[model samples]
Target: MNTVTRPRILVVGAGFAGVECVRRLERKLSPDEADVTLVTPFAYQLYLPLLPQVASGVLTPQSIAVSLRRSKKYRTRIIPGGAIGVDLKSKVCVIRTITDQIVNEPYDYIVLAPGSITRTFDIPGLTEHAFGMKTLAEAAYVRDHVISQLDLADASQDPAERASRLQFVVVGGGYAGTETAACLQRLTHAAVKRYPRLDPGLIKWHLIDIAPKLMPELGEKLGSSAQEILRRRGIEISLGVSIAKAGPEEVTFTDGRVIPTRTLIWTAGVVASPLIATLGAETVKGRLVVAPEMNLPGDDGVFALGDSAAVPDLAKGDDSAMCPPTAQHALRQGKHVADNVIATLRGQARKPYVHKDLGLVVDLGGTDAVSKPLGIELRGLPAQAVARGYHWSALRTNVAKTRVMTNWLLNAVAGDDFVRTGFQARKAARLKDFEYTDAYLTPEQVRAHVEGTARQE
Candidate 1:
């Protein structure tokens, strides 16, 4: 054990909240006050909101991923590994490195900001046949896969295979799902023209969910308008339905509809990172339950925030409501956690978490969008302007902000290049080797699953 006088602070996940907490702690604390170390699977803070644009080739991948070491803020250490398990009683965290070595990370105080994992289902063949649109690699791979599918369809001798290649289905209609459908639709439209052998009319994009509207949270009026636009684009919208079964060549939905599709994107919803639940603490909807100050109750030096923590929304009149796991909420919660941590070290009063809803934005390719900012609704060009501006402002660095803007300008002028890379689609059968283990299995659960599958086989 390395001995140090500074009260060590170990923060997990380098998302918006973790980054903000580190920034605030560095500015407020001196070397004598506390030592801060942030651990993440990736060194960069991924701006998840713009991932759909990247997949559509509207923006480059680097535009959305921000490097943590580039900024010379407080002397904080960066651990390039995702934390897998913890021992709250021992104040020791076990993290698996990129090289698959499990090491112990001991700390005096720890903050949990590790984000969420895609919430998958047990639907037949869903895990093996579906593509998720959450990570940078996944997004990039899907873009290439979609483009390649178009190319293959245009050149294929078999009409059935060609049709299957052109039919794409996206599950979940929230922001991630909706934006993915819209952006990829744009990519397909732009790239399919290059394939003169194929008719554009043969292509189809479908969005399905077990809900009444595409984006139910966007309310009836605005959601209705968005639906009309999608309906006009010939993109099939199936509500109150989900994929019942998926195969390599076809998918059966709850409505008993069969669509031959080479591509199926799984963006249904997110669950709290499994790391939170392992803390031996209480949780709500898979997120670790924390006090109003973002501290784990009954633990003096433990804190959690971001997507993994079930932080109470005090602005809602003391109701035990967990804050929504959006990037907007994560960023603010991070700063507050840092401030509270700093105050605790100095014997000062910690503040409560309080934030009002700031509306929502949904970009639907080209210049079409749906947004409600400051209690005012806007659609089309106006919504596009606000949506773009909001994301531009959300990015942490000016270099990132400028690069994104430049990319957008160039995309508008040059149009998107729809060449397919097919990196992920090629590895669809072995995604577990590439993705974090948290997506599917807990260590114990994985052992049981392996044993069970082996026995059955």
Candidate 2:
């Protein structure tokens, strides 16, 4: 007996958009309809918003890592690798696996959700010295590094060295940067009590950004409230400022002020994955240009979403305005794209992806927070409740929700143990370490690869 060949569907990345897309595809598509495969560097979908909490030891890494295998219902083939290049003409994707093995995958339909990398500048020593808060490993390593700094500071006899170790610089005023500075500052603040020789006053955290307003999207009033909250916690908020250079021991500001510090956390911004460029498709500001329906323009089988796609904001009734790269947008887009993909397979008409702005929430650690849920501005405890409540509800699986809730409750009741896993000991990772931005092949290389494979067969 002969079996029918199923349509191969390839999904890239395992972030919010990718994971949601795959899950939805598994649920909606019949067993014989399509063969789903996911290509990602990791096996889990990372809940990125709570990454700051993971770094500050408020939550364990496992709490935020939602395993893709958690579902017993889905049998999606998981490719533990990253797609380096895609030959859209041939419908082939070039992937580099974790073991440094290269392979080609052919698909009838492909979803590009490779997500974004931490955006760095041309400043000298930026990639060599700056720490990023974009990945689970980076977050864990940062926590260890921060704790180690305090330990080293207390042991040092030289006041200069101690001062430098105690001072920390975070370059970004966005939600990630602000929350990181706030959460880590609180960690150091609480940990200083254990060190008799270290003065709590010496622990300084400076949050800076080139933008004039910190999180200007929050509006002036709410942004001001967030700034005030951080300021009251002894965090120095510097607006309209940025790092000119970064060194192993110090960092210089764009305004020419030199600050001695052992730590430089860079959360400035993120750019779409370099994989998008391999397709040689039209892009808007480095993100692949896609229709409001989340399909690549002129390509019915190709879909792009998440941080890597410049999806038009149809909700605003503007063609130029694109959806912001937020978790909420990505999640909704994932579901929408899955429906569209299924629709295409069934030869049905597809609908556009349109979602209204559900507002923003910035958790400034502890009891401090600001939220604008449903256009209603809130601050302090009420805001914190709303923020946590929203995040808790957004978690994909029941296990993930339980772990996050348990971590939060445990941290609140017993406090952090301040233990380092030592996995990152003696291995300092910079901005370029986690983000393999330059790993993608050029369009010519992609064509050559696909053509070579075709000839070999």
Candidate 3:
């Protein structure tokens, strides 16, 4: 009797792209046709766009973390681990589990969507002292740290110490930096009511970036509108400026300004995952260079997308233009890549990824927002509605959508108490303590490991 072998498909990462790809595969492919497996350290898909809200206490971390197993129809095997290395020649991916155990997972076809990491510079004391807004823990820790500063300032009689604790500086002027500065400023503004002794003017928020404009992708008119909104809220906008050095108690800007502050929130930008370096393939700005179809050049059955891949923007008709690293692109690329995978399995021609820009939304907390949905600029409550509506619709599961909506309603009614969760009490909650980017294997190590595993098998 002859038996047929099924193709084994392995997907790395659990971000928007990876989750969307898995969902599409599960919906389209039968068990007999392909065996789908996903590698991730967590079983939930993080709704990252709302992370600023999470940091600001408007939403809980659990509300944004959608469970991967919520869809009963999905039959993909879940390996609770992160891919540390990939050996393309052997068709094996090395994953490090939550328990710190390294295991090798082999596949006939692979999809890489490992996502991006917080890009850092060699500025002094940045990695050690500064806080990040990239992960859930980081967001929670930022909230705790921010509230703690208020608490410390309220109890202290020293004016200098109080000022240092009250002053907050945020780097970068993009969506992340702008939203973070806006939301956290509101948190402090609201929380100050609880501290009657604390002067509201002492609670300062300085939003600085090297770029000349804030949220420049929102276009000139809307970008100026966002800057004005932040400025009106008393957020000090320092355009064309960046941090020269970061200290535990203060930060010095490139323009010769030393601001005394205990908090420095770094939301500068992101780089592709370190896993891309292990592939030993061509890359554009640290992102894997893939064809228009989101497949590796000259390599069959291997795909890359999302923040980790430099996917061509065929819609723009620009040879040098690549898709920007955004959730909107990531989500669409995920579904398209899965379809192409299915097409390849069926021996059909693969389709190239082509999509026009939908628009941009930046929720500035409360009823203040700015959005350009399909080129129509909106502001205030109308823009707020569009921003929240887009996010609510973008949420993957019903449970996530319901929980987020409930949080919004409750926050609007009762308001946040500015309670500190004491996440900073643990040293591991620090920005440098998380992510562990150094845990990945180098290209040479990956080659040796793959050869050794093959010999053992």
Per-candidate TM-scores read: 0.94, 0.99, 0.98
Q: After superposition, how far is residue 187 of candidate 1 from its true place, in Å?
A: 1.1
After superposition on all C-alphas, the RMSD of every candidate to the true structure, in Å, is 4.8, 1.0, 1.2
Clashing pairs in 1: none
Report the C-alpha lDDT of model 3 over 30-54, residue by residue, as the tens digit.
Answer: 8899999999988999999999999
- Point out where model 2 deviates above 4 Å: 1-3
* Model 1 Cα lDDT, one tens digit per residue, 1-457: 9866878899998989999999888888887888899898788889998989988989888998988777765488888888887777667777777787766788988999988888887888887888887788888888878887887787899999999999999999899998898888878877877888998998999999898778877888889888888878778989999999999999999999999998999889998888875666688888988889999888768989988888898877858677889888899999999998888888888898899879899988898899999778899999999999999999998989999999999999998886655564544542233356543335454344435544775
Point out where model 3 deviates above 4 Å.
1-3, 426-428
Report the C-alpha lDDT of model 2 over 353-405, residue by residue, as the tens digit.
99998999999888999999999999999999999999999998999999999
Candidate closer to the true structure by TM-score (higher is better), 1 or 3: 3
How many clashes in each structure?
A: 0, 0, 0
